[model samples]
Target chain A: MKVYAIYILNKAGGLIYQNDINPGLNKLSANDYLVLAGTIHGVHAIASKLKPTEFEPSSKPFGGEKEIPIESSATFSSSISVRDSTINNDVVNGRWNNPNTNNTGLRSIETDLFNVYVFQSLTGIKFILITSPNPIVHNVASLNLKINKGELNRQFDLAKEIFHNIYVTYSDYVMKDPFYSLEMPIKNNLFDSKIRELAK
Target chain B: MIYSFSIFDRHCNCIYNRRYIHDGPLLTQSKPSSVNLKNSIGDPLGVSITSLPPDNGSGDNFSPLGITTKSKESGSSSAINGPIPGYINKYNDSNASKLLFGIMYSLKNITAKLGDLASLFNTLKSFSTENFRVHFMESATGLKFVLATDNEVDNLQHILKELYTNYYLNHVVYNALSPVEFGTDANEHGKISNSDFINATDSFLTSLSVFK
Candidate 1:
């Protein structure tokens, strides 16, 4: 849940807003930030358009599905009976319905230091969320559950929430203001404070 | 208690719309109507739809010109029928979806006029009063996401964004069949056809706290 920095790019790949919430990452020059935003935007466009290479599933889907029922059977039945099964079904179905199936859109790139997540708005604005790598590994290990795709998907979903909030804030505080021109840099104090609040 | 959700493109055309009916408490407080009274003046007991419920009261204070009713009534006549007649309705009897989009569109433009503070004024995310809350999210390109919910719902911006990411972008924008071209749809106007996205949205929304 530790977001390193956030970068917001306009439709033309211009850096409209950039902030480093958790300091320590090497800072880039103003020009360099622009380049970074453009590069990421281009790469995301290319990636999203890339045709996926299908690979055979190494293990059968049912093999993994059977394990969940037996492991959490007791807890599953004790909850709200209506939703428990649907939740379980989502977990199972999500295994095959990975949103990043094509591997086209840049989802995340992980390193020992940090993880970069790219969220593209419908109109081509890109929100880049850089977070600490392996934020959930220790917790998952302590829980004694084998870390897998499910864990990563949950993390991705959480990052989407962060990006979503940022998007909302950006649209409200930046887009509505009559003084703010499109594709221009955002410098409002309220927007900055709101971003800081979200970081906290 | 969200009754409906809608998305409008930059041009203000409704791109996606869906209605959710809940059996729980209605957000608008319907007034007790004096109905079924004998007409001493010889007029038939035709339903006059009197007391067409307060449009959630003070929310319409912004419409000083009194134009919302004239415009909304004309547009709604063809699209919407009153919902069971007894409940106070936030929108008019015509097209509830269109009115929602119209309000959001006008509000977006009005709020964007803050000049230097304009940068401080971001898009209208959501505005809630009394029992009803309407959630909103706009993309940099002005694509708007709107949803109506009960005031108790939290983190709804995430859900709206999820709808933008998982549903709209994936199904409408990415799908070649459903081109990003607005104005007219080759398939159907203001209709989205991706079942995968719809089902996922249905499940996700139904699992919300507001629904319960």
Candidate 2:
């Protein structure tokens, strides 16, 4: 439940900010952090590509599908239908309930030592949090233990909430600054203090 | 549900592998209708779907014979080996196994180095991807047992221990014919091909509540 580090990757997959909030994990060199960020970015992209296609329902319908669209309206209905169709498709595809539509890519990587949660914003920026294992999983060094799914899910929700707060602070302290340039290293003291507060 | 189980020797060679294939749809929280489809089809073993026992629940309910009493309908293992389509049946000596071993080896070292510098036994227990979760356990002798299951399933440390003490020790280690260390030489890359060991493992795993 403890966050070890935080890495912010820009839209272009470059490391813009890195911070270590905890001391459990060994420290990495500055160059190593950049390499790690790039490796994670690459792995995330590759993992999304490795997503199984066979399980997904076909995007296009067969036979009468094209004919029904032609017979619908042909004028203003086309624009409305386009929007309606996507919603309908999302419902049919069972993606309407998904909380993270923008984050259809890699969500998390969990190891015995820690868990890495990737929160990709709609704008394509990524917030990666490396944290210790869930409390239930913390006693893995011992042989006998029970894993409660309810607790794990609650931790995951808490992580999302943390990201939401970080996103808000970023928008305020980093994005609102007139001197701040886009896609550059975040060096603002206010943002850093806010992040520290949130991490605590 | 458990998708596959693999064993890696001290030398990072995959000595044994088993992959299970099922026709049921992937068990993701997003799809409720597909779960209904799976229910209607019933389990291949035809065991009645029983609710999972709570933490510290009664142990007597589980039969001693291990005939899969609990149902894992809530969780599902996606397509076995998601990225690879044609490499289902190939086991042990495959590129996939080698790559898996390599990942585990490097990650184990990283975890060990990152943890307390004074302690030497800070090995990695498990890791998970978007699709499946791998549960790992290492023996004092350095034998690694890796079990890949659905994401919903949690800590299988006890299961791995059971496999090591009950099955592996009896079938492989105690048996005189099997080699002590696997893949020690160029020609004798020992694979755990013992029929007795395989049958025992199959029954043991099939009897688990998680196996579907």
Candidate 3:
């Protein structure tokens, strides 16, 4: 999904990065950002279990959940095995060549105020990207919607592709630069340029 | 005395035996090397190891197998011929030879195994020096290799000195013979005998000797 906002939580549940690219969302104090990321992660996890799930379909053995999978719901096809647990479902079902992971955690939340995308690296470092949702994202369809609507969900694929590009750009520019420290704000010239291009 | 001779088809003890430089270290006496004699018919990949005398600090008058002495002078690329370093950032002839040596470690033995490299061997001769230049005569191609270095040495002893000066060299070499390999009878003199170097390098299986 095109990430509207990003939040990074340390393995110990400390928020590492929180940013709002769009103008609509309200900004938070640095400390409050941490508390918000941690609380939301815990709360979303609990809420997923409580969210009403649909009965399994008789025709398709895999589609046992409700008519629509919650945005955070991750599926692992029995075919692939992911040795690394850090990668999110959005990344795996999306583009990774390695085996699929059964578990996909809360990568983001799209609310009226802001959108958040969470990325956890192999070393337990989290990256959160927060951006203002396009006021125009009213009818954007996601990956599963292709299977459900049979209408060819091009917009959802485009959005996920955008996230993939952004993720790779962040990894190359921010993560690899020796000067940048963990959980710190990225100020790389390349990152700034690419983000601006994608923001457009 | 260093003239080359075709050793194939020579008889054992057909000629007079005299005190040679390498007799002490080599296993066979007045005989063709055990391994060379085997490959006399034909063994293309034959290789052996021979023991070389310890380093005496001289750069010229030295063997490729010798290690750097206590002076701990570090080597640099393209610095082989001159005191000044040349820009050979990529590995050239010097490094290519090093890589061949590395490959030899893995593939030589399985290809061909010869006993001794020479029927007679000569211990490596060395002289010590702190100067930039070293004088060397190659055995394989009979070429001379010299190098100039930057390190300075003040005492100016014999090991690194010129060959013509009688007292210039601090040490002399005998042959490939070591007491542990040939037994105590081989250790009669501190120096190696000529027969040793001949035998050490005689066989295609040259690396078999400790000299390698």
Candidate 4:
């Protein structure tokens, strides 16, 4: 759960900001970082296109009526189960209230050593977080057991919180600066300190 | 449910590829209304495929406006039906397979380089988009097994290992007539054409709980 690095890409897919929060990951050259950012941006776009087609059921007169209730109940039970296991009801409610705001592109990449999470804002700015693999996932990898969905959801919730904080800080410090130009590299000292604080 | 499975040889050549056509109740429930509407309006799948824009290789210039415009057009034109899922034998050389391999290759390399240099097997295991999750496993011999399933599915490493040690070893590796390595030339691309192996894999995969 250690954040290794953070990369911010503008709406045009340009790397506007890059920071190494921790020392676990190897440092990439500035040019290489730009390439990485561009690559991620490209991959994110391509991934949306690669989305698999949903299964379309054959025509049935009564099929629609029977299926709706069951599906709704399944979601209801799942949500209830999740809520029962955690005290953070507000986060769950917040997630459900605005489902469309969820980024419909590449979300996370998990590896043996680390995980990369991509959070795209409504304006299309991408917040990329490279971190150590979730401890729950690591445990499942070693134990060869079924992954606990609750733990994974908690990890995602934590990530969402971090991204939300980062977004708020960005809007406050970067967006409000009179000298800062849109889509340009961020160079604010206050913003830098806020990011560092969040990392800590 | 699992949508597709692919195997890449050490050379990064896709040796075996299988996509499952999933029309089950579980899959339909995800977006019931849209799928039903699309299906009822006379085979949107075929229409979508035919109307797909050509690959102009301009993915690098991805902008928010471009994505929104494209999605909106597609959404309005056809009710957004994804490609069918099933263990189909043909179309292994599709651009999707190539792109998938390219992604895995680059991401694996990046992960290995970024991690502690002393560790030997620092490879990418899985990546999830909003649509699906891809579970990956690589043998010491460099055969890569990739499984793309719905986001609910968890790590499939053990399943992959079982396929390797049990099915793959017994069917492809030990068979006397089978080629030792997949393809040497560009045309053939070293596809695994063994029916027994294919059938075994199909049955084994279908038997899994997640497959239902």
lDDT of 3 by residue, A1-200 (tens): 33344444656666654445444444456665555666544533332221111112224222213222221223332222243453576475765632312123333332333344444445455555544433443233322121112111233234445555666767787778999977555557777776657756
DockQ of 1: 0.01
lDDT of 1 by residue, A145-169 (tens): 2222234446667887787688788
| Model 1, span B1-212: residue lDDT tens | 45556666777666665555343222211111234333311222131222122333311111110111222232222333233211122222223345455545544443342111315333344433222446678877777787765444432556677778877777677877765655464344445545665566667666665553
Question: What TM-score fits each model?
Answer: 0.36, 0.65, 0.31, 0.73
- Across B2-43, the per-residue lDDT of candidate 3 in tens digits comes to 001111001111011111111122221111123453342223
Q: Candidate 2 clashing pairs?
A: none
Better of 1 and 4 by DockQ: 4
Task: Report how closely model 3 matches the true complex, as a DockQ value.
Answer: 0.01
Report the number of the highest-lDDT candidate.
4
- Real A-B contacts recovered, model 3: 0.00
Off by over 4 Å in 2: A10-14, A38-113, A122-124, A140-151, A175-183, B23-89, B93-95, B120-123, B140-142, B184-190
Off by over 4 Å in 3: A1-5, A44-102, A117-156, A181-190, B1-212
User: Which 10 residues in a row give candidate 4 chain B its minimum summed lDDT?
Assistant: B58-67
Each candidate's fnat, listed in order, reads 0.00, 0.15, 0.00, 0.33
Docking outcome class, model 4: incorrect
**Highest-DockQ candidate:** 4
In model 1 chain B, where is the ten-residue run with the lowest total lDDT?
Answer: B58-67
TM-score of chain A of 3: 0.52
C-alpha lDDT values of all predictions: 0.51, 0.59, 0.30, 0.65
